[model samples]
Target: MDQTTTTTAKKVLCIEDEHFIGELYARALTKGGYEVKVVIDGSEGLKEARTNQYDIILLDLMVPNVTGMEILKQLRDPSQPALKAKIIITTNLEQKEETRTAIEQQADGYLIKAEVTPKQLVGILDTLN
Candidate 1:
């Protein structure tokens, strides 16, 4: 008898308004065996995220139409259904200490966009699983 093992790829949603950054993460994550979806607008991203279908959500603090902070607040609100996806705050914006602490309290992980490379992002996701 023969046996085989298979693992389902983790689905990732990247909410980034920067085209270059979004594509870069998407390419690297896809290469790392993750099913990656990139949304350029915060409103659209939030809509997709509300579906609760992704395993991870990489949220940029400065997206258009709606801010990532707003999305985070809505998703983490007790009024909504519990979210199964790990929300990682990815941004280059420098926040006040109080704001940062608030964000950190709700997010699974926080990464500065300027400091992390695409490869490093993939590595971080690997550890999350």
Candidate 2:
């Protein structure tokens, strides 16, 4: 008799407002064997983040309804259940001080959207573990 084994794909949630960017990441991640969910609205993304279980979260800073920073703040709050997933900030903004603050606030990693391609993002995720 022959038996087959299957491995579960890692889950990733991408919170991005730009439709093209979000789709690009989603397509790449899906191709890389990850189950990817893209949320275009920050508020909706935050709700999904709190409710769902994911291995990693790709968050964009300047999103509508709720900013990624606010979502990170809430996720890091001691009062909330510890967010078990790694949170990586994906943004085009290049403010040095803000980057420092995000790192200080417990962001697992940060990437500039303009500087990273989807394949590179996958490489980054691979190094996380």
Candidate 3:
């Protein structure tokens, strides 16, 4: 008789363009018991998401090459929700339409970057469930 055990870390994928902000988040989340993968470019970010499984996705609403909304749509597509992961969109822009649009696309949560700190951001992940 053998007892088997496996350890899996919570994985968080961060799709953000700002170098300082992205690095700030990766470091903060990494300290909060998550395995963090940060991608700065929109196209590369999409590729990374497709190739990985993440418990949560922290995305910037404004990214080049592939807008965050496009990424959200791709993730939540009914044809392939098998790969769908919990998404949280963060942005400096605070338009009601953007919030409504993000909710329509299935973002688990939305945060205004100007109003959040790295610590608060990490704390927010605890509410994802």
Q: Taking the candidates one at a time, how many backbone clashes does each contain? A: 0, 0, 0
lDDT per model vs. reference: 0.94, 0.89, 0.84
lDDT of prediction 2: 0.89
Task: Order candidates by lDDT, high to low.
Answer: 1, 2, 3
Give the per-residue lDDT digits (tens) of candidate 2, residues 50-112: 899999999998899998788888878889889889999998887579657766668988888
Better of 1 and 2 by TM-score: 1
Per-model TM-score, in order, reads 0.96, 0.92, 0.86
Candidate 3 vs. true structure, TM-score: 0.86
- The count of backbone overlaps in candidate 1 is 0
Task: State the lDDT of candidate 1 residue by residue for 6-113, as single tens digits.
Answer: 989999999999999999999999999999999999999999998759999999999999999999999899888889999999999899998898898888999998
Query: Order of all candidates by TM-score, from best down to worst?
Result: 1, 2, 3
Q: Where does the lowest 10-residue lDDT sum fall in candidate 3? A: 95-104
The regions of model 2 sitting more than 4 angstroms off are 1-3, 96-99
